[model samples]
Target: MNKQDRLNIDTKCINNNSLNSSQEIQEFLEGYEGYQHLFLIGFESDIGAQNCESRTGQELGPNNFRALIEQLQFPSSNSFYDVDLSSLKLAIKDCGNIKPVISDIEATHQKLESFIKQIRELSKDSIIVVIGGTDDLNYPALCGQSAYSEKLNLIRIDPSLDFEDKYRKQFDDLEPQFLEHHQSHFKMTLGNEIILEKLGEVLFYGIQGFKIDQDHLDQIQTKLGGKFQYIYFDRDIRKTMFDIQNQEQNQCKASNILMENRILKESQQIELIVNIDLTSIKAQNAPGVSEPCPAFGFNTQEIEDIAFNIGKQENLRIFTISEYNPAIEKFQTGNVLCSIYQHLLLGIGERLKNQGQVIVANEYEDIGQQELEQDYFMQQAGEHLQLQNFDFDPSLQDFK
Candidate 1:
């Protein structure tokens, strides 16, 4: 199929000058040279969710996300990260939704892969933000990025392990019953040997103990070895936040510190693909998902912080959010998801601000050699402790 037939643009959300007082993100240009561009692409399908016996409203996630994003006003010139927003020269384009080939999952993935490759060809440095369908979209997104990058790092923010043992076989070779039970991550990573070879430093954050099976965890550990690491939602994440709350009087600053120390690291220069599943968020904050986590998950602020941190990575290529079900939404999940996109833009703006700047010798010399050494040591110590603490078993708790 042609590009026009495979994609559906939503005209209602694009440059509608109805609201004159404030500027919405939708007003940004479809194309602009010499600017840091952000492309918004949507995948409209829930067939993968249906196959996995999950809820079915995720097909509408992209449209709902765009609707809420249209209602949010873009950051003013003086309001962005304490820096002049105009200097960033950011451009946002809504590329519209990919017309899903409902008859076959492989066909839909091929279309998505082709679309992403085209975007990469157009602007090699542009950031791509993919919304909805299911986490299954991650497979195609990775396939597209692989065309440009050989070494890829993936960070999955999800509660469940999403490992289907049957996905180890080729998509065409899988039996009907096995195909029906496949999840995104395992199918994309463990199932495909090509992807596993290129993958580097996979991190699973916000993991819930009860949602995953012990056998899958064992297999992941055995296969990936030291490269695979995870942080539990209940044990590590919440406990760290509770500790921060007790130590720091300011809640906002505390959250910032938590994200910076735990997730964001300046030393990470490798290319990254961040996949976020809405089910990783707390049900109270994001109840609309293929599968809701009523008892454990990241809060709204925490997830937003994570999005912002992920955006700041200099080599971040693709950012995807999946499994958002608007059918059961309580009118809050859409707004929360919008905020995550907005924060990601702000973080991108911060990255742009740091690019192409000339640093003088005097400015560099201001930092004492002693202070530099201390900072390096502190970072090394923190990394060591983080890895050491990751050796715990997730099956210890029965949160499910």
Candidate 2:
């Protein structure tokens, strides 16, 4: 990495009018530059079949990846943004400084364990951006920091809920069909990578149309308590026809989304993730995948806007982006990739708040002066206490 490669978004952007983020957001990004807070992590399995399907070509290879890193443009970001380049390269360069660290999990189970451990150790409350070999990887990343299995707010904004116990649908379409229907309930299916511990743990937004089975519904309602929230948007079916209220309250305002039957009733906080699978975009923008769907605006810029807002919230602890198929859309892929990077970068700028260090300037003098002050106070307190015999009873309040 060169001097030009790093991006301290918070410190640099304080004066810029272009990227207006809140103070809370400014603090998040300021401290985020610490090694403990930034990770450009990639994950893939080495099973011959799975590896070929998931990891083989999906990586931010050295050259192109470096280019992206070298191009990040934050306010007064050490002068590199001034370097000359065409609009395209300049745009590609805007992705925040993403340090590439690919985790290619070989067939061995130990490798997975090692990868997870290293990531947790390295992440000191910093953001871990993993290039997913499959959507399933989110489970481990989230669990790595879970507090005794207690649920935190986790949100998955994909077109569909790609929640499967097994990868294969028993040589059947039930799973594939389910995948399609799930998309109808979502804007797209970028991160079908979900576990069914609780439908409440996940929230599906941008859903359009869905053909959910009764059994699935029962499972969610009975077993999972229908705790998750789903903002289903059948765009082609309804096509978000109203913008009359440009006063759009939120992304969910655009479509006729179905909220979870019971989760809303209970009303608890959720963990949120916003995933965008490539094929969700127009086949022309991002093509070829195990599953394909035709729907525009699934990448609907609004989703990104929603993502920025969601990404900004103080409660959102983890942020993950997956399934960017470059092999499918070469020409446009860079821009899409750039957008993903920019969102995370700027979002990092928005969430990784760093309270500038508090330098206690009068170190020696301050410490000596403080000790003298403490002695004077202690002596005065001793005299005051000598006048009375009293028992401290603060802790006994609870007993009473």
Q: Tell me, what's the RMSD of every candidate?
A: 17.5, 16.8
Off by over 4 Å in 1: 1-31, 74-80, 83-87, 166-176, 180-184, 244-267, 356-400
Total colliding residue pairs, candidate 2: 36
Mark the regions of model 2 whose C-alpha exceeds 4 Å error after superposition: 1-36, 45-114, 121-124, 147-149, 164-200, 208-217, 235-274, 288-290, 351-400
Q: Model 1 over residues 1-400: C-alpha lDDT tens digits?
A: 2212111122333332121111223233332345676778788878787666667878888878877765654332326365444344565667667767765777777777887887776566678889987888888888888787777788888887778644334557655544533274465566577778888878788789988788888889998998888878788777776777788853543235435543346326667888888888889899887678889887887887777777778788899988888888835888888878877876776776778422234433432343355459869987998988866343441110
Q: Give per-residue CA lDDT, model 2, range 1-400, as digits (tens).
A: 2223222222232222222122323334443323224434444321212422343333332223334433544221212222211101111111122121233232222333244444444333444454543444455455444422244445555555553222323344454312211122221222323434422344555543452344543444554444555555554313443442344643443322322223222333544334555444444444533344565435544434444444344344456555554444433544554455555444334443332222133433443464466559868887887878666453432101
Q: lDDT for each of the candidates?
A: 0.68, 0.39
Q: Which residue pairs in model 1 clash with each other?
A: none
Weakest 10 consecutive residues of candidate 1 by summed lDDT: 17-26
